[model samples]
Target: MTRVQANLLLLLAAAIWGGGFVAQSTAMKELSPFWFIGLRFAVATAAVLPFVLLERRKAAVKTSRRHLGLYLAIGLALFGGAATQQVGLQTTSVTNSSFITGLYVVFVPVIAVLFLRRPPHWIIWPGAVMAIAGIYLLSGGHLSALTVGDGLTVICAGFWAIQITLAGTTVKETGRPLALSATQFAITSLLALIVAAIFEPVSLDAIMGAAPEILYVGVFSSGVAFVLQIIGQRYTTPSQAAIFLSSEALFGSSLAALILGETIPPVGYIGCALMFSAMLVVEVVPELSRRRAQAV
Candidate 1:
């Protein structure tokens, strides 16, 4: 649970999340966005419920109305981000979806500064600029290709940042992170179901057709990746966690190319490099300084 170990786990979580975009995009072909989200979160809730109950049994976890309210609020934010991102994916490429979603790293610090009144380090701005450029390249270089989906994904990133920040704030107060996660998923599933009932054509056929992809996203991305994020962030700072998680875009783009026959233009690769370099500057350089100071 050292910082290095935590960071590595975050990287693995990002890789899983990266591959998840492919599953989500593919499933969208056979399912409506709300249906896919509902099913995915439903499965995620089921997967996490057992672990949550087990943890509750081992520990004296007390749940109050206030705590439930907090979890519900967090869940709503998560649901909004997921739903919008899925809708965006319907019209956007996986690469575009991921790169734009990855903007949460930038958004988190900005939100921290603006809403939470937390001042960010000087490095955050430069890192954000680098990530923006990287996203542009990752989106195939021409800003003209940006669509409403891209805008929605950007908004999704902001919501996700808020969710992450809120989750970090509440995790310490809640004894059962797993249970909280389960509750969040359950709430999200319920909300998605409501949305599906009204807007989406949620039939059994669509669910069955998208079953495999939904299972992958639910089990690996939502269930497992989220748990890892909670655990890993316990040992890392939010900014550091953001840097590690941002790797999802890089991993997603590469996975899409290999698995989905998607290819990024050369300029896109350069953009990815620039974005990654900026993250390294933000995260790695501080650690290097600490190590050097320790050596002296």
Candidate 2:
């Protein structure tokens, strides 16, 4: 697919994820976080497993043990992010969880710079600062009284950043993006099930009651959207993909307002604007400069 097509797919994935927040938050009324998460990813694993097996048959090369290790690490990151966000949703507004999680766009570059020693363009610093200011505004213009859910969501964003960074490299190196996604889903589901079995009350009646939410989030959000992300990344740069995916925040907040009737304060809107602007600065400026240079 062309880059533009890939980006559009990413945007679709973002929209799916955006609405997924509602499913996740609503299901928590009837389910524990671990139980919900475990069941959701179990569905995701089942949804993606057939594709992974089909691809495995088509491709002669097998995944190495090293690649499996990488998949495990990626799965752990996914679990961290998903579990934290799930738990945070119990106490946080969907809008808050979404915007805070969207901070992963900012975290991605920082992670790249710090751990990978890759220097980002000059715009990254200003964008990061702007996003920080946005977070402050989103948090009622003060950082001192942030809620536990907010803090956990921030940690979720960090883990999401890790997962995003690893996904591209892992996919490229292994040449089995679909299988990798399926494996991660399996691992995350297993871990979540184990936790749910230990700490949370898991009941079939509850699962059946929340089946619609689970199916929507699991099949579409985890299975379809994740596959779209992997395919989208193959055709676009990580920077571009981040920008497109970051729209999940806006979509989430809007959906919450419309469906859940949750209203953000005016200041929170300003925060959203600032955060989105920061994302644009990071993604758009470089592309504009490159285009201008090409034209010249």
Candidate 3:
């Protein structure tokens, strides 16, 4: 796919995730965090089973036992990110979680340079700065007042950055994106299930009560959105993907305003503008550079 198409897919995935935040938060009313995560991913695993089978039949999907550790690592990072975000949402306001989790927009480039030995385009730094400033303003213009929950959400952002980078790199190395996606979902479900069994009380009635929310998040957010992410990242740099995916915070804030009737302050519009500009910077700068080189 073209870079434009890839980024658009990433944007769509972010939008799905943004909307899933509501289901995620609502499910908390009837389910414990780990139980909710476990059930949601279990449903995701089931939803993706058909695709896995189709891919196997069409492309002869294959995975090596040697890559088992990498898949497990990806799944563990996903579980860590999702679990922390859910638990953090219990105490932190949605605004706080949205903004704090967006720190991954910055974390991605940092991690890439430091460990992955990949230097992002020069524009990424300025764009990341703009996006972060937008997040701070979009999140009510202050970060001084933070709870323990906010801290956990920040940690979640780190794991999310790791998961994104790993998924991008490993998919290329493994040559079985669908299989990798399925394996990670399965691993995440199993891990969440084990944690829930130890820490949370899981009952059939509770699961039934939260079934709609669970299914929505499981099917769309975990299954479809994640697959889109793997596909999109194949065509774009992780840094670019990070910028697009971080728009989840923007979408979440907007969706919450619409659905929950929350009010956006006057400054929030400016924040939104800046965030949009940040995304454009990532998209436009590379094209501009390519054009300049061609002209020269």
The lDDT leader among the candidates is: 2
What do the candidate models score in CA lDDT, each in turn? 0.83, 0.88, 0.80
The best candidate by TM-score is 2
The alpha-carbon lDDT assigned to residue 210 of candidate 2 equals: 92
Worst 10 residues of 3 by lDDT: 57-66
Clashes of each: 0, 0, 0
lDDT of 1 by residue, 54-122 (tens): 888876647778788889888989998998899998777787777778667667778889878998767
Of 2 and 3, the candidate ranking higher by TM-score:
2
Error of 3 at 23 (Å): 0.7
TM-score on alpha carbons, each prediction: 0.87, 0.91, 0.82
lDDT of 2 at 239: 68
The predicted structure with the larger lDDT, 1 or 2, is 2
Model 3 scores what on Cα lDDT?
0.80
Better of 1 and 3 by TM-score: 1
Candidate 2 per-residue lDDT, tens place, 1-296, comes to 89999999999999999999999999988889999998999999999998888888777567788888889999999999999999999878999888888878778888888888998878889989998888888877877756889889989999998997888688777778788888888889999999999998877889888999999999999889988887898899766887898898889999999999998667888998998888778777877777889999
Model 1 off-target regions past 4 Å?
1-11, 58-61, 229-244, 279-296
